[model samples]
Target chain A: MISQNSQTILNVQNLHANTQNTEILKGINLTVKSGEIHAIMGLNGSGKSTLAKVLAGHPDYEITQGSIQFDQQDLLALDSEERAQAGVFLAFQYPIEIPGVANSQFLRLAYNTIQSKRGNDELDPLEFDDFVREKMKLLEMNPDFLDRSVNEGFSGGEKKRNEILQMALLEPKLGVLDETDSGLDIDALKIVAKGVNHLSNEHNAMILITHYQRLLDHIVPDYVHVMESGRIIKTGGKELALELEKHGYDWLHDNLQNNAGATA
Target chain B: MNALANIDYLSSLLQTLSTQNPGDFPKDLLPENNFPWLKQLRTQAIDQAGQFKWPTTRDEEWRFTDISPLSTLTFKPAQPGNSPALADVSPFFIEEANNRLVFVDGFFTPELSNVNHKNQLVVGNLAELATSHSDVIEHHLGQHFKSQKNLFSALNTAFLKDCAVIIAPQNTVITQPVHILYIATQAETTHYPRCLVVGQTNSQATVIEDYIALQKPANSSYITNSVAEFSLAANAQIRHFRIQRENSSAFHLANCAVSLDYASRYQAVSVTLGASISRYNLDIGLRAEAAECIIDGLALISSDQLADTHTCIDHLQPNCVSHQQHKCIADEGAHAVFNGKIIVRPDAQRTDSSQSSRNLLLSNQAKIDAKPQLEIFADDVKCAHGATVGQLDNEEIFYLKSRGIPELTARNLLTYAFGAEILNRISIASLKHTLEQIVLNQTQHH
Candidate 1:
């Protein structure tokens, strides 16, 4: 899908970010085109989720030195909601539970807010309910989830599917999914992958930050990047993910160190 | 507000409270000839009200709640001024309610009241049913509240000339809910609104005790000392909805006590939303085996308002179950207090009880003091209690914001959700929708 005219949806250059007092992301570089799917694989503390949150303009993180050009505009200038309205979405690894607010109402508000920003005709409650239900079917989500509280009392797989369901509804230009496949079972993961794939067009992009190659099988990333300690050390094609799956991270680390020693 | 702070002695405050407000207490009490027992109860309560010291923050129960500002208001007793027409009061009316008893300035207004139930259900003013239901009233009136000896209850009982009373006899089930409206017409006056609900054997009913201001609430700085007593017979059930939305400048002190017999059930949802200082004490006693009760409450306050709710569910017999959940949402410099107490006696084995108090502070200056108390003596009983006071969850807000909702809308959604948890438990659909809309508006654009 990386054609000649595919737009550059995101470009991160020397991105250095900090949370509170600690520098989490130190001089990172990444670029995602409109039709490209990038999979950033790393361990637990590798700051993959931090990158996703920073892209979504989460209030906790501060960019000390970096520039994120999203769709040829500065992404860092927008607030969280403004970033969302600009078609940037982050599917949280641990989705926060909002009790007492119905999922349908929240979904409609979000959908309408984004649609209004895009100059599209926003759907009313009944229209949105029907629309969301169709999108939910893509994720194999039960219609009953629309009435319940957002993410409250939902099963792990169900919460993951809900995140994907939201992704299908928002139809963001750049979707930063942080560990969305971690808690999902095989069936849910495929359903979520199908939902995400259905939303991806040549005008949009996705950044999949996952720990397992199992998800990359269904999503099929164009680029596989290995990150260590807040920096992307190695980049390769889709086969690199399978290699990482077989040898684990130590193979890449050893090769990286040997190459560094030879080069020095 | 600081004027009452200078009076250090509660006794002197109590003295001034009683002497300056002659008309605040009933002058010509219900005649002893017709209602001698009630007259005696009122007389005893009058003496109790006289001797009792004004509650202060020094008392364990009143700690964190300072009601001394009540002395600043002129204790002029409100009168039954021009009664509000149907249009003025109809906004507070529940659409499904067929029976209603209206009280204007603590005096039962027969012209505005109506009871249309064809069954053996008794719903009307207490004074009107004095002759026929006298025996029933005599046995239950002030019977549950007599032991509490609370100064506010005593003051309310002393003014027990007239109040809303609903008596559901054996095997009777009320089809529609009964609405008891307590309206304040005149400002700067002290009024006492009382309620007595008796559910006989195997009977069932729903009663709504609502407080409202006749005109604009800001101008009505009345002092309302209200008391409501519910007594349930064997296998009976009563669903009560008590709403206290007095004026912002008013003081509302209310006492509600319930006694459940064998296999009976009592469920109440009390919402407190107004008043400069409001205190509601609710006590439920499960007197027999297999009795059950669910007590839920919510208080939404902002500005200089202070709302306090103290609830006690006593499991006195074995095989009883009680569940209580109280929530408060405080913004601005407002203060909200919730004290939920659950007691399981020695003989109350196999009793299951749980209590939780959730308070949401919407601002840094907003204060909430939530205390959950569990007293269990039976090892075989199951008891659980918890209390939490916090601001809106930032992660939750971010989650909503990530979904394209604005930050203010997200915060309002969380705040509305916190208060709506209790309001959703309200059995009445119209009232639930109303209160939910009110909370929605209160949490918006702030």
Candidate 2:
């Protein structure tokens, strides 16, 4: 459990987002305190990924209403790269493969972009080499990978690992992992979970969006939220995940349908 | 500008060609005794060329490239001259060639040519072979490609007196490539050269057509009108390479057409590095299902030179695939043009086609015009086309420079990477290596 004195790092109120002209997220209100691990679970068509993308300021998704606050500042006012510089990182569900851009070069550019935004001196290539080497050691990644093109031919597990590596290098205050464990194997899941666990600190927080309860067995979220349709239907402690795993989402889905029928 | 519209220039050019009595040439070069159809074809082509006027900028195809230098030249029909004594006027892989056919001033020289592998490869002049092997020549010659609306092709077919023909039998894979060398020795001269390659079912072969100018001291202008036709039978494969390195004062216009049968594969690779004004017309027709065609080419233009390539790939059968990629590097007042079109007929369903053209400009005065077009009539097909013309990426170059690489080396490395994608598709190791070296040398010199 997070301490009561932990400051709130993210405040989202009545948020609504859309792509083109179709609305995905209706009205979402959520508050995330620092140093806490939260998991958002939902079905395939629900707005879980939408919320993650909206928070990251993806250009395609427009916010129709409401406001998002990050660390006492307006988060919606920032662009995608600016949000990245402001200590907010979103692990893409499907990472883009940018050919001709080397992995090491991309990481260094991203790192310097964020660091310079914070008024920190940028590290030279040699300095960055040393810094990333240490971080890669922690994640158990091979150093030779730095020379390859960014995600050009990487396997699903390797791509997820590379995302975590970027997260480690940036050290953002709020890291949103959008379905990072979807395609990972057992060993890969353990390594990714360990990387996330080691990066979480008193000044940072994480929100894991997943569809399966199998991932929670390793990541061990402090808070769990069940989302249906376009909003969260239930919020509880860790045992709630175990309860849902035992009975399955169909029970809760049927219960919700019956409740709606009764109310009507 | 219609700079060559002066009637005086045309009259003077005709006079110069008629006055210079080179020697007695064979009037009955294409005999009517055998392959009489070829004689009729030549007469029709000459009539067509005579009726059509020289195109200027008013024509859509010649809008970007100017052919005034070609029209102003007094070009005479070249007769058979002595073979070039130097062997170095050949391509990179000439000595190891299984068969070499040398043509000097539009006439075949059998003594200087080498046909080392007897039964595996068949190489000889097209006119001579048409007389000796009339049955085979009449059946296969001029069966695939026809004279289009292009004037250069009409003229080439009109004077189609000298050409080379190569035939590989079924299931025979020649170990060494066949080389076709066409050397122009005199200026103020015109040469019409044609080559026909027929790969039988299950046969595989590579052919390199090299165009070179032997004498550099000639002050007059020259014109080379050429055509090459390739036919690939079912399950056969052919790799065709064209290397054009003519004189700086020369004008070269070439047309290449290929037809592929069921399950056949055809690849055309062109490297243009010489000539003051050059134009290449390439067309590939996928006539049967499951056929594949790839067109890969590159041009390095510099010093007031103009290079243009126009290609078209037609998918007439279902389940066929075609891919084309061309790159141009222009610098120092040079100009380059690329126009590629891919068309899929209504009955050609499940066709997967893609075309891309990329240009890199090194100087502010250099110019490039690239257009990639696609016309799809089938709804179930996948088609895409794209063209990009821009300077080098500043951020990428800066990143490399910061890593201790000099600015020039970084730029060269990035440019090499841009062209490496197409080079990687070459299956021949030695050819690929030679091309890489040429690209490196060109970039460094620029």
DockQ of 2: 0.04
**Candidate 1 lDDT tens digits, B253-340:** 8999999999999999989988888999999999999999998899999998999999888899999999988899899999999988
Show the colliding residue pairs in model 2.
none
- Which candidate wins on lDDT? 1
Over 4 Å off, model 2: A1-264, B1-23, B26-35, B94-96, B147-149, B218-221
Residue B208 lDDT, candidate 1, scale 0-100: 93
Q: TM-scores across all candidates?
A: 0.91, 0.65
Reference-based lDDT, residue B251, model 2: 86
lDDT of 2 by residue, A1-264 (tens): 487779999999988888989988888888899989999988898899888878877667888899999999999997666677777888878776544456786688778766777888899999999999999987789898797776779899888898899999988899999999989999999999999999998888899999988889888888999887677888888888887888888878887799999999
TM-score of chain B of 1: 0.92
Question: How many Å off is the CA of B98 in candidate 2?
Answer: 2.4
Q: Can you list the residue pairs that collide in candidate 1?
A: none
